[model samples]
Target: MNLIHRAGWRRGILALAVASLLTLAAIEVLSDEPEIALLIGEPYKAMRQRSTASIDPAIPGHSWFNAPKSDARLRFADPQFGFVTPLARFFTVGFSRDQRIDGVRMSPQIEPLLLDDTLKVVLDLQEQWRNAGWVPIRAEEFPSFADTPQWRDRLREVKNVEKAYWRAGDKYQLMLVVSRFRDNKRPTEERYLITLGIHRSRGVQ
Candidate 1:
């Protein structure tokens, strides 16, 4: 072959090699296991930073709801809170992907975590809030939530529900709800849903 033809052949080989490398990288990113996946990039950085973006409400004692250092991918602020509803902005974690949580929208892509791992998250949240002087309210205390079938079912699932509130003088009270559920489909493909929300206190106005 002439020099020009030889050069063209070399260029084609180089392009083909680059394409193969890119394809392999994409596969590694998509097929990463859960424990390693969450620790890979920005989400891991946020977790290490112990970001409280979603939990830090405008109310007092927000510092109490921070996620545990061992956990990652904990999101508190629902992306569509004030735009869609007047209710206080919500919080949730453990979903494989983020979802619009205006108290109505639910996430289908739940993350599968073991029961023990799920409880660790809930206890972490409850401990911090309790230390900050937030009082745990009984179900009967909030007739509206206690009476709702949806809330009742959610509470019954795994029986891991925590409801508490903290007051900021007389201005307003921040109500907190946290729950975790396992989506039992396949043993190897287990998933769990850890949800949390902050709303205006049930009765105090």
Candidate 2:
């Protein structure tokens, strides 16, 4: 084809792409929703804040009955069991990929982690366990993970490394990824709960 034709075609294609993006943006804006996903991970390693998410007027909630927004900004204490990062940003949106936060856009392409929620937390824990320098011990019952204690403690890096939650039918189950502590194994994944639903499930022991 001639240069003129090719240039025209390129311009048209670019225009179409821009138009598509604008349309998507318009749609997203029109929707009266949070329009984001949240990320959640295992118990954050160090920081601890006792919080209960309840219907807050500060956030956009119901007027008469006070309905809570379907979404909210997500944050996490560092996974008590050290994962590569501490927070999950699937249901929430944090800073970056390493720090346990992405964005929950409408697309499945997944530009980053979503708001801090259940899925994000679980994924972060799985990653931390994967790289804790243990020989893989395959198991069938757990179905999602296995435990193998075959790493050297020369550097003393792992401080009570523990497994994360894989969703069971009605409840959550925790595992032990690594448990070599500095002083004592004080971190029990049992202490963590869904960052979003902590108030609702006030029984996280």
- Candidate 2 stretches with Cα past 4 Å from truth are 1-16, 19-32, 35-54, 57-139, 145-205
Q: What is the C-alpha RMSD of each candidate to the true structure, in Å?
A: 17.1, 17.2
lDDT of 1: 0.40
lDDT of 1 by residue, 105-166 (tens): 22212354554554455556555544544555443564213335575465556666556444
Q: How accurate is candidate 2 locally (lDDT)?
A: 0.32
- Provide the lDDT at 181 for model 1: 49
Top model by TM-score, which number?
A: 1
lDDT of 2 by residue, 91-148 (tens): 3222332332222111111122222332345445556545542222224322333222
Best by lDDT: 1
| Residue pairs with backbone overlap in model 1 | 54-77, 112-191, 112-192
